[model samples]
Target: MTLEASVVHGDWEYQPVRLPRDVTRLNATAELGLRSRFGGWELARTLLYADGTRKVWLRRKLSRMREGAAV
Candidate 1:
């Protein structure tokens, strides 16, 4: 439940997504796909930990139309 700060690189914004070790592969894939399909988040990067945890970076285009609405 640790939320990290979002990063803005050029015209894209990146958010860190944590996949716990307990989640199954099928569930994870479906969930990520849902996020991409509905939230406009795309896979940017990923790091697999030794304990089977995942640290993923989801990126999307940055829009300045609203304040504090990029999360």
Candidate 2:
């Protein structure tokens, strides 16, 4: 998978998350938020990594939440 990021504001750029070939992209934002917070970053580089990581995480969380509700 390829990761792409866009320059947003003040030396900070938003990274678009790309999942690896074998990984699945979750469709939940809550999960992403939980995971993002869990990942925890204290530096610019770490934050960059966390930002993308959160997307994937949230996607998955959302997917699961939907599934659970359906049942």
Identify the runs in model 1 with alpha carbons over 4 angstroms from their true place.
Answer: 1-3, 64-71
Please tell me which predicted candidate would have the highest TM-score against the true structure: 1
| Most accurate candidate by lDDT | 1
TM-score per candidate, chains pooled: 0.79, 0.24
Across 1-71, the per-residue lDDT of candidate 2 in tens digits comes to 34454334433334445443344345333434554677431123322244344322112223444446646
Model 1 alpha-carbon miss at residue 11, Å: 0.6
Q: Can you write out model 1's per-residue Cα lDDT over 1-71, one digit (the tens) per residue?
A: 23368888888878888888997889878988998999889999988999999888999887776335644
After best superposition, candidate 1 residue 56: deviation in angstroms?
A: 0.7
Give the runs in model 2 whose Cα sits over 4 Å from its true position.
9-12, 25-35, 38-71
- As for model 2, its CA RMSD to the true structure in angstroms is 15.0
Q: Tell how far residue 3 is off in model 2, in angstroms.
A: 2.6
TM-score of 1: 0.79
